[model samples]
Target: MARAQREIGAALLEVTRHADVPSEALRDDGLIEAIPELAALGETPQDPHWHPEGDVLVHSLWAADLAASHALEHDLDADRRQLLVTASLFHDVGKPQTTRRMNGRISSHGHAERGGEVFRAMGRRLALPRPLVDAVAAIVETHMAHLSVRGDPSPRAVRRLQHRLAAAGTSLDDWGIVVRCDGEARGPAARPDASQPWRRVAARLQ
Candidate 1:
């Protein structure tokens, strides 16, 4: 069982590394089939007001493309770029399990943390390096933190986030990129100041 899982992970890593990985390839190459976890995103419902893109899977694909495009624009090193893309693809992996209709709306509270766990487990099963796994998990867990910064925007909150990234073996710059990509994928409802809050935090950290 362990060996089979490792093989599956390796295949996923290869797919993620492909520079031309189309959103359609997610289904075409049987990646979603190999990794059943991905299919869950399709069934997961998201609040239409916030996720005009439709479903978690659609948002994730957009996020991955945006992250890859940003990585290329910024000339991020290959490994760092791969990490960003991979994290983007899996960032909402937990929403399917956590989705609930509450107060006449949908909410996936704690989905970020749950997604982090899913990312970590998949990374481990794929036999990815421990540091890489930690970095991706940190990105997944904190993906929502940037949005929250719009409310707080405190220097202390920024510093705490910086510390959290540091402890997770990733840098603020990398996390910022991922967060920005996530914001870009939010379609019409995306906050115009999406990147500003994190930029403020990063500036204070520096």
Candidate 2:
């Protein structure tokens, strides 16, 4: 079990540090061998209407790559890059558990909230650092913030989200990064306005 944990840690490290496109870091078999649940993420289905690209795994890898590019293009420091890449990798880790056919449509309602709980649990089980665990979990939980405020968003709503992120040891900027990548990772028909989350963050939630 300890060896397995190290392998898991090592695989994650490879993706976080070495892979420009994260999935490229692992040899084909290395990922599923080191981390099976992450592999299971590959089997979980998403609605084509929103994810014509494929499963949660495909979206995740794409998002992570986008995040890596963003970090590089914007000159984000190593710590911030790690946080963004790791958060993107784990953003939808809860989908396999929460997904279901609902009213004839594929839905993983409440997945972001559930993803946060499951990520925290997985991080503890892996003996990961408390700060890393919390920050990633917070990002997973709120990655959907822009959608929740779609159409017209209230200042109070924005401030509440801002405070929640701050309390979690991350901030709106980090959350916005995840949000933008997530939106961009989807099929064209399903992608939200990538600028929306940034607009709210730029407002300073005042």
Candidate 3:
């Protein structure tokens, strides 16, 4: 991780610890039961840059909601829906661990990597299914790939992603939906372009 991100992550962790905020408190099951206002925590409200809908915290909630709604429409099996919802909710949990303010442009920079680590720790603590844990990790790792490639991912880029998923024994379809959920929830009119190159890449796998 970058130096600035590392420092910020430490500081955020310090804040969480100092506040005696349990990670479990933010977890789906725990939050649903313990903190009725859990959904309202850590959110950044509307801004001109990046999040037009609000902060990363709000965007994460939107992603989780999108995943839930889409899973219901597809009539996903209970296990699949569980995986999708859990992954969506927890994918960016590491952002709180590593908040960076560069030139007043707040960015988590390397939070994807740190966030994946956070998810892994959370999964182990919760005793999540091994495959589900693995799937979530992959999704977290590649969460920004679509954005990084903009709208024109090369065939080579697609192939590389496919190869990595295959090696991890994960499904592009599962992760693709997670990515779509994220894109659709990021801001006002936040729907992802249906014709995005990466969506085509996912279709080829289907």
lDDT of 2: 0.78
Model 3 misses residue 5 by how many Å? Answer: 28
Better of 2 and 3 by lDDT: 2
Stretches of candidate 2 exceeding 4 Å from the true structure = 27-29, 190-198, 201-206
Q: Worst lDDT window (10 residues) for model 1?
A: 16-25
RMSD (Å) per prediction: 2.4, 2.3, 9.4
lDDT by residue (102-137, candidate 3, tens digit) is 676777777677777877775565455567677778
TM-scores for the candidates: 0.89, 0.89, 0.72
Better of 2 and 3 by TM-score: 2
Estimate every model's Cα lDDT from 0 to 1: 0.78, 0.78, 0.61
- Candidate 1 local lDDT, 139-164, one digit each (tens): 88987886674454788777787789
Candidate 2 has a TM-score of 0.89
**Model 2 — which ten-residue stretch has the worst lDDT?**
189-198
Stretches of candidate 3 off by over 4 Å are 1-48, 189-191, 202-206
